[model samples]
Target: MTTPTLYGYYRSSASWRVRIALAWKGIEYDLKPIDLVKLEQKTEEYRKLVPTQKVPAFVTKDGKILSQSQAIMEYLEEAYPERPMFPKGLYQKAEVREICQIIACDIHPIQNLGVLIRVAGSDLEKRAEWARTSITLGFKGLEGRLEACSEKYCVGNSITMADFFLASIVGNAKRWEVDMSEFPIITRINNTLSTLPEFQSADPFHQPDCPEELRKN
Candidate 1:
């Protein structure tokens, strides 16, 4: 089978989640970095691949175009169920998806690149505040929900889609300086998940377009 193409920027949390899923599932893909800072996403060429011209768009080997990180993740889960993102049991699967939605819908969209750049305008401080407020509100509820099932991972002992979402969100939180020390459960879970090779390999800083000087170990 031919490898799919994943178009995304390194710093994009949405893109990062898809990367984690792909890596964990062991799917080989080609990266087509859509450098947002360079305004490459707005070009006519990129727009043709994705109507929304958004980062993290996936082109399947059969030439199908998939957009939206959460949708793409779910598609991959169903298509490539070998490394299943959800555990057995109906209720448990719903719980995992609930957590993923909390991050993807509630927290991520409000503070995403487009929204932040649009609302922040020229005010750097406001941008940080936007990120902090959005993440805090989302995390507070998420922390409560996670406490019931979280062990080494979000849903249970095994890694699920929730972990991928949480890891990506936490990465963005730290970058935005959200002071996540308050969410001990989130911090703890993220700390554990980050040490894994799948997580580490999908890290934003390790991607090709990540600036050399700005890269972190």
Candidate 2:
């Protein structure tokens, strides 16, 4: 089968999640890079492919378009079913979703690039503060929950959907100078996740669109 295509920005956290999921599933894909910083995502061509013009629009091998990182991931889980992204128990499944949401909904939205860009014009410092504060607040709760459920990964001994979101948001936190020292559990989990080949391959720094200076060392 021909590889699927992923339209994404190198540094977008939401896009990052999809990349990691695809890599974890061992799915080969072509990347259609969109430079979010340069507003290239607003171009009419990209908008036609994705009305919202957001990065991380996935084109399946059969010529189907899929959007949204979480939705795309769920689709992958159902379509591929190997290297599953969720655990097997009733509460385990919900806990995985819950942790993913805590980062995606609470931590990611306010710190979104669009929101940060809008905030940048008025007060750059506030934008940075907002990103930092959002992560810290989200991590504060997430740290406690992980302590209860995690052994290695967020929901169990293996990776899950939550690990994808957690790892991506941690990258965001670092980019915005969010203090991560307090969230030891989160940092520890990230340390483990960061070393995995799939995560390493899907890292923002390793993306095709990534600048040479930012490429993994």
Query: In model 2, which range of ten residues has the least summed lDDT?
Result: 113-122
* Highest-scoring model, TM-score: 1
RMSD of 2: 1.4
lDDT by candidate, in order shown: 0.92, 0.88
Q: Where does model 2 exceed 4 Å of error?
A: none
Pairs that collide in candidate 1 are none
Q: Can you write out model 1's per-residue Cα lDDT over 11-120, one digit (the tens) per residue? A: 99999999999999999999999999899999999888888988899988787999999899999988898999999989999999999999989899989878888999
- What's the C-alpha lDDT at position 201 in model 2? 88
* Candidate 2 positional error at 127, Å: 2.0
How well is each residue in 11-51 modelled by candidate 2, as lDDT tens digits?
99999999999999999888998898888989898889899
RMSD of 1: 1.2
| Model 1's TM-score against the true structure | 0.96
CA shift of 109, model 1, Å = 0.6
